[model samples]
Target: MDFDHIAEKKQEQKATVWLNLWSNRSPELLSMQLAKKHRPGETVSACLWKSGAFNICYRVRYKDGPDVILRFAALGRAILRREKVQNEVPEVFGSGICWAGPYIVMSFLEGMPLSQLLKDPSREGRPVLNPQISNRSLKRAYREMAMLILELSKHEFNSIGALEENKRGIFIARRPLTFNMNELMVSANLPEKQRDSVSSEEDCRKKFTARCLFLNITKELCAEHSQGPFRLYCDDFRPSNVLIDLSTSRVSGVIDWEFTYAAPAEFTYVAPWWLLLQSPEDWESDLNQFLIRYFPRLRTFLEVLCNYENKLIEQQLLSESQRLSPRMEHSMETGLFWVCLAARYSSMFDEIYWTFIDSQYYGTFTSLDDRIQLLDQEQQHEMNELVKLKTDQSTEGKESFTDHYPIDKLLEL
Candidate 1:
């Protein structure tokens, strides 16, 4: 991706009113646009998180009293508009969902991003932390995060006027299709040997067939098993979207709920952990600590919460399986259908794929060789079997997967 170009596009696409609104309007004038009352001469100081992709956030402060964070929608206007019309924004904000939005104005939260503490040694972006902070401090941060996740899981909302109530709302809950590991392999821009092995003609056919089946199964399941009375929120839950106080090491508040959806509770439980770009190791380590220290009294509560989420997932799957057209159910149970669908949705696939394969960002689970070995035994086997069922008996097509650009090229962005 062209970072400069993308950044330029982002700036251009950001709502003009948002970019200039605060700059042009003094605090007195801007206060008129806000529903909340403010005192005279309140100064608004704005600082943007340049690394964010979906929303533009500004930190606003008053000479007296507290600070507030204002977030404006950055991309996908239709989705944003729908969220606004449905009143999903207020619901999500009230429920404390993270990382979903069009625009939100909230109280400015104190403390720093965890990235400040865990700066990458190879990168010069952020300053490194003092080693003396101790392992206990790190664990405390993670434990706090876990408690926040647990807390958010309990809040829920119903779909009152979502864009596609039947298809998109939480009331009509369905398991989101799983991430496609193959596309991830392709997008990682790996070596030719690795790419060639995974993108064979047989692999594509299997993926396509499997995707067809999964959708069918999912449709059937929704028809049969979807229960009424569900809650949903902007589903993007990540640490960057949270604010934490260094002194307290507790989550001050959760921010960003633009993509919030009303669905089965499981959707919220798993959404926070899907950023293939972030290392699971770091998350597990950090969150484990946060959970331990922050919610020491609530350890038993975690299991009950997880069980509730699992129950929803189980019901959704069972209902979908029972209603599935033979073809659909077959595809879903096998995992081929979801992978192929991911390939067709190239943009989504690419974003998620990059997350999994971008070892620099997310760090590999093991060596490349080890990952490939596992892939062959697991992912490759599933894809191969599906392809055999979907394609011509005589000829198997083969293609190499290579990154469109190298790491150096990506860094230049």
Candidate 2:
């Protein structure tokens, strides 16, 4: 896929943050002009908005027709077009882009975000209506969430890349796999000498090629046993992106369609981050307390997810396609999803890799000096490089906090 577009390119600052700040500090006159250009003969009834960390939103209503919401990506638009066909997301009203910022207008869909719906609404910015989500109320909500994922994962494409359209049609794998591999290589925590060697673009490109080959091989290992074909998926398939109807406890619509891609079935098969309504990296200071509650819920979630997959298989939904493989299945089992994410998000590499992920590939060993004696010479060579990386990390500093890896049998080969 278009590797150039993958988020590894270096920039001066957080472009999204800059854009957001600029939009806030600057006048809205230009934004209004943009809206006017897109929808001629319509009055700008209101400029309602909720500014997010990266994007700034505005609710613009037309006097004669339905209202639409305008959203801007401070970093700039990633993919060029709006995929209007995906019903789970808001309808794309139109877009108005300029040097200042990039913006798109979408039809205003009702219903509160699932996050607000599930939690206490008495708090500020909670959904106006609170749906009962006690231990009893969670099943319907969870099942609907699971079902949405199952249905959405059905749209498949031949290649592995970001979703984009061409003369042919709306294709999931149409875009090039454009993530910054250079950044990943830099994340290895190498000795200063080894790090200096990779200063040139050629070196980075070589590492990029190697990384891609590694990922391809890993993906194939999972693909051999998968039941479904590779398909388009939202990278951020969390609760915050989902809207739910309070009365029925059903998913009203799943928004945040940007950055969706046709990835390996293995990627989608992995458990989502929102399963516990918290992220591994940012759960809280009281991590142990959180996981005590989270693990049981996670087990039930996996049970429901797997059960749904089985039902799909029984009904022959996966007749021609592949199913979730053991490798992808181990995502939750090993928390390897975090590792997978680290490929592109290199900054998190040392923490995730050394803390937990390294054991999966290297087999059980005491330290960098310890040997498993199981891998072949070439595999051992790779392990040595990894060991050096780990050693460098240790030399730099120890992990600030410690906890057991959350799941079972993750350290085993």
- Per lDDT, the best of the predicted structures is 2
User: Which 10 residues in a row give candidate 1 its minimum summed lDDT?
Assistant: 176-185
C-alpha RMSD in Å of predicted model 2 compared with the true structure: 10.6
Q: After superposition, how far is residue 78 of candidate 1 from its true place, in Å?
A: 8.2
**Tens-digit lDDT string for candidate 2 (1-413):** 11121122222123444555565754365555666667664755656476543356677666776766667654422222222122123456567555544567676666677766466556464232233456555655567777887787778767776665559887654453322322222222221322222323433333333344345436654655355466767655677768777777677777666556676566676666565554444554454465576666666666666777778789887642444434345775665575565554544444444444555655554743343343356765665575456345334323321211111111110
TM-scores of all predicted structures: 0.45, 0.65
Each model's RMSD to truth, in Å?
13.3, 10.6
**Model 2 misses residue 94 by how many Å?**
3.0
Please write out the lDDT profile of model 1 over residues 1-413, one tens digit for every residue.
10222223333444343446435645333332341342234565545543254445556566675665555443322222323323333322221222233345555667666645544345463233333445555455545554555444444454322323444543423332211221222233322222222244634543343344334444454443146344443444555566677777666666555445454432332223322214232233334353343233233233333444455457663333222123323443443333333333443433323333233222454543343343434565675665554344223333322334332332222
Give the whole-model CA lDDT for all candidates, comma-separated.
0.39, 0.52
Measured by TM-score, how close is model 1 to the native structure? 0.45
Worst 10 residues of 2 by lDDT: 404-413
What TM value does model 2 have?
Answer: 0.65
